[model samples]
Target chain A: MNEVADLMVVLMAMTNLILLGTARLTLGVRLVGAQGALAGAYMFAANAEHPTVHVLALSALIIVAKGLVFPKVLLRTLEKAEARHEMEPYVPYSASILLGMVMLASSVWVSSRLPIAGLTIPPSAVPISIWTMFTGLFLVVARRAALTQVFGYLVLENGIYVFGAAIAGEMPFLVEMGALLDVFVAVFVMGVAVFHISREFEHMDTDRLSVLRD
Target chain B: MTMYEYSCLPVVFGLTLAPFFLGIINRTKAKVAGRQGQPLLQAYFDLWKLLHKGAVYSRTTTGIFILGPVVGLAAIVAVLGLTPFAGCPPLFSFIGDLILFAGLLGVMRFATMIAALDTGSSFEGMGASREAWFSSLAEPVLWLSFAVLARLTGQFSLGAIQSEIGSALWAASAPELALTALSLFAVFLAENARIPVDDPNTHLELTMIHEVMVLDHSGPDFAFIQYAAALKHWVLASLLAGVIAPVHTGHAWIDITAALLTMAGIAVATGLVESVMARLRLTRVPQLLVGAGALGVMAFIVDIMR
Candidate 1:
């Protein structure tokens, strides 16, 4: 179970890099969804010794919220916004990949320096969580599109959830359910925001959204 | 088998096998486009026919134009001697020969560039400048990759570095190995003037880099340029192959066979890239090459971490 969880950590890091390098917003969203599902699997793998019904239920909620609900909302937002591609990204794809690697390495270094004795999860879990969080933040800052920023938010949420799973044996079911609801509502609102942005601007470029300020 | 026996094989086999890559690439492109291509021996036949014909020179050009193909071909052959195939050590090895091998490519490019400049044609001059600029960016990537490999193998010679990268090094640092290989692959594509950099088939002078530079050469001179280009392609491809698929079956014969097969695979892969990808805008070429340099740096970083 530890080996599988360790492998899952590496797999999540790979998906993060893939998200960083891809120029298509749709592909990025899809890769984030895959990362979310892998995180859900990681939750179970990390908590194999202390499995409970609450743990199972929370993992399921995470998978539904992150893996299915978030991606569907973002993909629809992409469709409605008519912005399938991320054109003229703030950072180019290749450089983003290099930056992503640097971030991953730094995250691992930062996690290593942290006091992680309280978490019974594998040593790799801490690094993976921190790296995912860093990548999510990078996505939000480095991308120019609003929909991709929403994905960045979702990925950020997934990272926190992984860290929570690694530290806590079982999260309370009500808190898990409420967190999922909050995410769903946030994405719903963001999706609507994207539509409105598209309707007003005819394109989903947030860089041009400065026209709204005056 | 002994090291002496292995050393001479790559030189003989490389010269014989280099031109066939052009044929394979053409056939693969043809197959993808659903056309019946020329025979696999077409590149060889073209070279044969060209060598039999008389040389033609531009009236304005000096002797530098004649020396370009000769120097370029000699440099490539020297590079071939320095490079390892499969797990076999090269015929020549010296400390810091890796840098010398890279310098040989620079020499070849210099010769080509001077030859192009000597033609005194605007198009050739433009091509020469572009080549010089792109190659300047590409050299960093090549060196960075070498740096990573040198760190991993603790060897500075190209032969030593390549021959030492066996399954153990791969097992220990697969990600670093992969990053370096990818970096080198990008350098290979750009250096060889393949698609996404320069389209080999494009007749448009403005769209060419390497081809435009050689536009004045004809007959035997052109033949030398063609064969040298093919050999250059083979050397770069073999460097990549040596990294990505360092299959050492212990038996020298099997290792040599694996190397040959991998070269064929690289040729096909190049064809597929040409068929699927559109060439980038001329301005985007530097970004692509710089990205390759970034990959190499990342590989070096990864190796350091390991």
Candidate 2:
């Protein structure tokens, strides 16, 4: 079980790098899907013996919502908005990947001193979650398109959910439900926002959205 | 005179005292701008009157319009519980809370922005867009800054950072503190809708950032909106002050006094900035945050080298 957890941890780290390196907005969504899937597998591996119905339900929801639904929603959004590729980035992919690797290594190095052995599912899970979050942030900062940022948002939220899992508490169902509802509404809202962006500017570049001034 | 044991006290106090802080900020801004501003308790009166009045809903507004302020207040309360004020630790503290604190603020931003768009007004949508854009930049700066603090202090918890930092618990130096303090201060002001980054006193919606988003909210909802905004500033300012204040209160009265003075000093500082400067163009706000991000980078470098 611990070895399975370690494997999940490595996959988690690779997903973080892919999320950092990918410039395709559609691919960005898919990486977020992979992240969510990895997080679910991690949670399952953390405790295989006492997996309850609620755990199964939550993981299933993570699979459907994050892996399948979120990507589909984002793809349809990018499709409707007609943003085909991330044309140019503020930070190039190679640099982002390198920077991301540095961030992950630093997180691991920093977290190594912590007593994560007692606190979390796996000690590496701490840094992995942080790296996952940083990759999301890196993507959001580097990408140009509005849809890519939404993908980044999904990735950021996925990292957070994984962090929550590494801890022991069974999160209140209502809070989890509230979080899911918030994500659904946020995706819907982002859909409307993307349409508005394309409609207003006839292009979905977020840079053009900077018209409002002081 | 005693602080409540529940995590809710800081929240209730934070929420209750929010209007007064706004009043103070307005008064200072008014004096600095050379107008006799509204009374120190003017926001309180506004809240009272607004609470008694009937609400007039816009025809095009959706359920989110009604939902915005309620969730807004809820979000502020949520964030307050995540913080510690004066000598009191948070009612609850846990790992990764620093990130969770940012997440809660994002929730507030998310709720308020959605509500702004729900009104179906282009002006409100404009505010929503600007809010989302700037805050997206500001959030990472916030997380990274906190992460720096965490890395230095070796504590993953929010309330634990200061006690660890203050006791000379960590060997980190003042220059690193300088970078952390300044960048976060910038993000704080930007987050609070203050001057240079944003002018809270700006009258027109086009020229406004945070205020314009809540233009449609009226009555009690508007009161909640105002209080929530004030509470947010208070919370952020408190966090900023926490890094600098000696934090050894010696007594509750001293702690309260120090806390109040710190809050007022921040208000004055904000006022001075407004008095001395002009709002940056919208395009420039990101650079300001990025400038702050650069400061974080500098801090990370400085701390790592140390």
| Strongest candidate by lDDT | 1
Model 1 compared with the native: what TM-score?
0.87
- In model 1 chain B, where is the ten-residue run with the lowest total lDDT? B297-306
- Compared with the true structure, all predictions reach lDDT values of 0.84, 0.76
- lDDT by residue (tens digit), candidate 2, B1-306: 244343455566677787787777778888987899889999889888989987879998888889999998898878888887765667678988887889889989998999899988888899999998999989988987897888888899877785566636323355567668888899888898898777877888887878888898888898888778888988898788777664554565676677778878887887778778889878757767766765576456445633
List model 1 lDDT by residue over B1-306, tens digit each.
466667877788789999998889989999998999999999999999999999977799999999999999999899989888877788788899999889999999999999999999999999999999999989988999999999999988888888789899887777678878888999999999999899999999998999999999989999999999999899899999999999877898888889989999999999999999999889878777767776676566545433
Docking class for model 2 is: incorrect
**Model 2 spans > 4 angstroms off:** A1-214, B1-9, B167-172
lDDT of 1 by residue, A6-79 (tens): 66766676677667776778898888888888888888777777788776776777777788888898888888
Candidate 2, DockQ to 2 decimals? 0.02
**Best candidate, DockQ-wise?**
1
Models 1 onward score TM values of 0.87, 0.58
CA shift of A46, model 2, Å: 53
CAPRI tier of model 1: acceptable
